[model samples]
Target: MDVISAVGAAIRTAFDMFWDVLWPLVLGFGLSGIVQALVSHKTMAKLLGDDSPRSLSLATLFGVASSSCSYAAVALARSIFRKGASFVSAMVFEIASTNLVIELGVILIVLLGWQFAASEFLGGIVMVILLALIFRVTLTPRLVSLAREHAERDAVGRMEGHATMDMSVQGGSFLSRLLSGRGFTSISHLFVMDWASVWVDVAGGFLIAGALAAWVPESFWQHLFLSGNPTLAKIEGPLVGPLVAIISFVCSVGNVPLAAVLWRGGISFGGVVSFIFADLIVLPVLDIYRRYYGGRVMLYIFATFYVTMAAAGYIVEIVFGALGIIPSNRAVGIITHGPSWNYTSILNIVALVVAAILLVRFLRTGGPAMLRMMSKPETSGEHDHQAIAMDRSIP
Candidate 1:
């Protein structure tokens, strides 16, 4: 194709990809908002306290049920961190939201392969544990103090997002809601929060993916990543793939396609997993960290995460290889269709529009006023274990 036609085609392709995820992003974000309402800062604070294994496990479980949006995950991480969660627990929440969600996992299997999905799942658990271990050893008292100072600063200067309406649950047994008895209004509140959290991440991811499709050459991907030299190939592949993914700024399941391309071009198994793990370190997420935490804390956390992800990837690759379960060879193309007009895309566009409207409204209303609009349930106790007030609007 001629240069002009090629560029034109690329633009259309980008648009098509964005179109495809637009609705899912919206629906996902709304659902995120809803879940946020159901989960109070008190509940989250209790479930993500310092030095408690129970807290960590609950945080992970909460994240899995939360939205699959990277932005939302970052937001939530920042919020919980500010609300007095230990750095490790906060990071666990971030990992679980990005990697352990149901929809994202299914999407990875559909677009990449079952193997990729499995790696992502197991790798995420390993990553959280590695991070916890790192923090336990390397995170000094100074670092903890520094994080707290930053968290306080962030709590004060935090920018407003769409705050979920406070959902009021009936004072009843758990079996009631689990069986057949949630109020309709409470359910709606849950839906709204869910949408708010996941959409922005999806939108940001799609925008980045589109830009890449429009400008980056497929061949360029092959050379930097793909290689057959075992030593140079092994570390280089994992390292470079994640580096590129970080700069590319896509995260969560949205990263699967680009990862698949890198793998197909001959990047190693470790490389693919590293790329997946690098989701939280992307530019936007880092920016969120800087905003929520201070520059020093952000730097420390970033360095820690980068090392932990790379190590986890290498370890998993070695273990899997030794076990003779390294998937024989790399999986091939799974993103069968390119950008096109479809029901999914149409839904995404509609969702985006709705999200935009809510964002505008939230901005105009301002954070405190918006929070006031969300009434709390009468006689609710203080958030568990928090030394400070926190915004639940975070991821």
Candidate 2:
């Protein structure tokens, strides 16, 4: 009975955390879908063909406009890279897509507070810049060629269909494209697709977080995070944060809930930020990288990502600490409070209605067929043809 009760408690905790962020997730994904509907993948590929500062900037912008699912983002990065985007630009895009997207920022603000949101966005840019510099110095012509060769071989990775699908409404003003029947269909499809891609990671993250919160003792976390030594904790936090994330096997915005658990358990502010940023380097992703870019490139990516993630954490920790914006109180409400009548609840209700409407539109518009293709390996032409057919069916 005790064991069952413990399991129930953990599940309940996870559900509460999900409820708290439901509205923000809906709002973020909805906005992301709208942006994906408006922006052409081909255009993004054309703009990111080189690793110039201009190209990198455009990659960041386009990435922010893309899906927040880490797997989708990684898959799309490979797709763009294969389509002529520079390796550096492609990686930067992947980072921004997962870390700097609307959904991630909104969820961070809702759960961890504005400081974390600010740190994530600001640190994300810092990490990107750091990664770009590292790649410039370390990435060689031969390495790039090798990676491209492997990518062109089209080794199947998670979300291959999603990566190749180009559902953007073409040839119209932004508002016209957004409000058009095709635009609505495009948005609904992308929204549902994005949700389908990362729901597992999100659910897993919540359950792991809930279990950790319910089953683990506070002292254990404090010891693991080195809470007893202030100076050392700050230094160690950034160093160890990514390692924790790597093992957790959670990626995308899903890791945010676990981050909250860590924060309350006495991880330094920077540690939490680094943990969030380290989703790309999770174990499963590393294996995907190996398949996509070969073993050597995978190791290179993992090394570079880890160093930059930790550096970004350290930088944010110092800057935010100096500015006194790092939240001292770790008692975040989402971790402690169950579902209650509040603004969060009200927003969740409205958000669910909006989501239901979109889901209905998605189901009516052949979304299941598209979803079935989400993990399949396909040629770019096939993806394009299917996208066009789906759009035509809507009208």
The candidate that achieves the highest TM-score relative to the unseen native structure: 2
lDDT of 2 at 278: 95
Q: What's the CA error at residue 260 for candidate 2, in Å?
A: 0.2
lDDT of each: 0.61, 0.90
Clash counts per candidate, in order, are: 26, 0
**Which lDDT tens digits does candidate 2 get at residues 199-227?**
99999999999999999999999999999
- Which residue pairs does candidate 2 place in steric collision? none
* Model 2 / residue 202 / CA error / Å: 0.6
Error of 2 at 369 (Å): 1.4
